[model samples]
Structure formats: structure tokens, C-alpha cells
Target: MLARVRRNGGTAEEFIGRSGPGVQARVPVVTSEGANKVQDVRFVGLDGPGWLLRGTITGTGAVPGSTDAWSCGMRLVGR
Candidate 1:
């Protein structure tokens, strides 16, 4: 799973939130000038029988821009 949060400092500004899911053995983060940033998310899940992966993203704010997104995926190695 991977998630991110971003906010703008103005009233009329905006905030965004994102999330997703995947099979990953490791997550990497990079830092520079005392700030941490996400480098990347690597998916390492192997394809096998009944393997499933899913993800969802949601956001809310004062404005009507709030929304949500969902997705699902699966694999059947042998059926």
C-alpha cells in the first residue's frame, strides 16, 4: 500500500490525498536538505493462483472537490 498527503497553505488553496495498494517487497524514500520525499514504490508480488491486489483513493475538503476512487485486480494462475 502507498499513500500520500499534500496541503497548500492558502484558504482557497487545496489539499490532496492519494492511496493505492500493490505487492511490494520494499518501499524507498529519499531525503535531501532535511526533507524526505518518496523515491518510488516497487511491486514485487509474484503471479500465482488466487493472487489478488486492490487499491482505493479518497479525499475530502471544504469544497465539493472531494472524491474517491477504487480499483480491484486479481489473477488466477490455474483455473
Candidate 2:
């Protein structure tokens, strides 16, 4: 996954969140001109018997001031 991001000129950080069933990854985009930009994305996945369910949070919900991402992640894992 990280490799995929790098292939497109972006960087990713994978981390384990406190309550999710799987690891969460954040891909922050690097502006070629000068500024560092954060991508509003949180990918949460749950490994199942024969499949995996993945969820993504974007927009303001993926930023520091929102709980929508966490809530959605929990819902995905809980399923």
C-alpha cells in the first residue's frame, strides 16, 4: 500500500489505532512546489474468514477535528 502511494508521488504512514480491528494508514501528499499537504483519508479494514472490508473517510471527517473516521472504522471492524 505504501509502495502504491510512493509510486504516485505521495507518502504514507501506517499505524495501529487503539480500537480498530486492523491497521490504519494515512497518505499525506507532498506538494512539488513548496507546501506539505495532508490528504483527508483514513483507511480501515477488517480481515474476515475469506474477505476484507475496507472503509475510507475523506473531507473534513478525516481531519483532526472529526470523529466520523473513528466511528466509521469501529463500525467496519464491528461488522
Candidate 3:
């Protein structure tokens, strides 16, 4: 999954949060004010019998060390 991002000219770093192993990256965003911003995002995948669950963390939840990220990750990965 992360390989696909790097192949497309983006950066993907591995991280272990409450969600366990996942990929993190900084993505460019255009805000409501029409200003450019670099936002932190995370992608996590869970696999189950012939199925996959993908979750994304964006905005405040994407900030490193933020409790929001931890909580969200827990909910996503713990299930």
C-alpha cells in the first residue's frame, strides 16, 4: 500500500501507533481559505478471511502524539 504512494511521488513512512503497524505521510491540502497546507495522514489495514479493512486518519487525528489519533487508531485496529 505504501509502496503505491512512494511510486506516485509521495512519501510514506512506517509508524506504530495504537493501531500497530501503519503508514504515515504528509499530504497537501487546500483549505477553505484557499491556502495550501501540509496535513499529516495515516493509513492502516486489517485483513480478515478474504477481506480487508482500511482506515485513514486525517486532520487533528493525524497529528503525531495527539490523543485523537491514538483513540481513533485503537478503535480501528482493535476491532
Candidate 4:
């Protein structure tokens, strides 16, 4: 899974175990007109449940290891 980040020229580092080793990556998203945009991405997979949650934050203030958006996501996903 980490390879997916490296393949896009981004680095993937393991989380601090707050959510069971979630993935942190800052990857580039290519635009239609031959442009590149860097995006902060995080992914957490549910063990033994075949479920995965992926999040991407863009625009200003988007960064790796940030939890604001993730918190919002969890709320949307429910408890």
C-alpha cells in the first residue's frame, strides 16, 4: 500500500498508532491540462472487516498528519 504513494512520487509514512497505523501521504494529482497538484492524503483500513477509508484534503492548509478533516469524516461515517 505504501508503494502506491511512492509510485506517485510521494512519501508514505506510518501513523503514530492513534488509529492503528494509518497511512499518511502527500501525493500529486495530475490535472487535465498537464498540470500537477499536490494533495494531502490519509488512509485507514479496518482490520478483519474488509473496509477502508480514504481521505484527501486540498486547497489551502491541507497537510499530512492533520486530523481536522479526518474528524469530520469519522462523524460522517458515524460511530
Which candidate tops TM-score? 3
What's model 4's lDDT at 22? 66
Q: For candidate 1, lDDT tens digit of each residue in 1-79?
A: 2332222211121223332223221223345677654332223233346865433221222113333232122233452
Model 3 clashing residue pairs (backbone): none
Question: What does the lDDT come to for candidate 1?
Answer: 0.29
lDDT tens per residue, model 2, 1-79: 6677667665556656633643233466677897777675655677779987777766765554355644444744355
Among all windows of 10 consecutive residues in model 1, the one with the lowest summed lDDT is 5-14
Give each model a TM-score.
0.20, 0.57, 0.68, 0.59
Clashes of each: 0, 0, 0, 0
Question: Could you give candidate 4's per-residue lDDT for residues 1-79 as a string of tens digits?
Answer: 7898899798888774344546777887888898997777666544336765555435442455455644323432343
TM-score-based ranking: 3, 4, 2, 1
State the C-alpha lDDT per candidate. 0.29, 0.59, 0.74, 0.61
State in Å the error of residue 47, model 1.
Answer: 3.8
What is the per-residue lDDT of model 3 for residues 34-65, given as tens digits with 9 covering 90 to 100? 99877788887777789887888787877666
Greater TM-score among 2 and 4 belongs to 4
Candidate 3 vs candidate 4, lDDT winner: 3
Stretches of candidate 2 off by over 4 Å are: 19-38, 64-66, 69-73, 76-79
Which pairs of residues clash in candidate 2, taking residues 3 or more apart in a chain or in different chains?
Answer: none
